[model samples]
Target: MTRTPASRRDDYPVFRRLQTRWMDNDQYGHMNNAVHYALFDTAVNGWLIEEGLLAETGAEAYFLVAETGCHYHSELAFPGWVDAGLRIAHLGTTSAVYHIGLFAEGSGTAAADGRFVHVHVVRGTHRPMPIPEAARQVLARLFPAA
Candidate 1:
């Protein structure tokens, strides 16, 4: 199988700083693979929340994770900070793909890189729907040149 290269923090359009918790570490000492996925989820979802796109009372639709994958370039443990760099790879009428890079504090290279595709659907009906204009506006910031 071919290998994918890790992305640099500079390649991303936005970043979220997340703290590694004590429970994030595995018996092997480094963070468990599951935690990395959690970080990816936290980064993307947290950004949306911060941008005022997601709210408990006003939410109309929910973006469901349709697919995700990750590649690790280095190991990370607890008690340190991680920078989750984010960018948009694609945005369709009802779907969006986000690319993320997890960088250790003060490191230029990424410890892990990942991508996830989300499909927008009505909250109660679960039927596919077009992404809201507000969401598109915020997502466009991640692709300024597009």
Candidate 2:
């Protein structure tokens, strides 16, 4: 059986709103599981970019997704809107694990919850690099409990 969705909205310090697209739903009439990853990526990267921590094409520091997974609690279809809640679960020297919850607009409960783990690497060498100080500060706000 599919896992019940878990809400971490209260746990997250910030959220990014995303509008659904007609193509997001599958023939089954609900948003496909694949789309969850897209939303996760968009929320995280969008925040990173907006905070001036990430460069789209020419940054010395880059992040590569190392792991991701999601659990859905309810059905969400196309033309709907969602708020992607984000928080830092774990921050290592070169990797950060983020917890994410997707809430339907005006819904306090989460439609899905999951994690995104990314490993920071140097652009030229592709080797693990420590998280930049700037990004860490923005990310640290999410880690206040740490």
Q: Pick the candidate with the highest lDDT.
A: 1
Q: What's each prediction's TM-score?
A: 0.93, 0.90
CA-RMSD of model 1: 1.6
lDDT of each: 0.89, 0.86
lDDT of 2: 0.86
Measured by TM-score, how close is model 1 to the native structure?
A: 0.93
Q: Across residues 4-27, which tens digit of lDDT does each residue of candidate 2 receive?
A: 647756767888999999999999
Worst 10 residues of 1 by lDDT: 52-61
Q: Can you write out model 1's per-residue Cα lDDT over 1-146, one digit (the tens) per residue?
A: 88788788788889999999999999999999999999999999999888876647547888889899999999999989999999989999998999999999999999999998889888888788998888898888876243
Indicate which candidate wins on TM-score. Answer: 1
Clashes of each: 0, 0
> Can you list the residue pairs that collide in candidate 1?
none
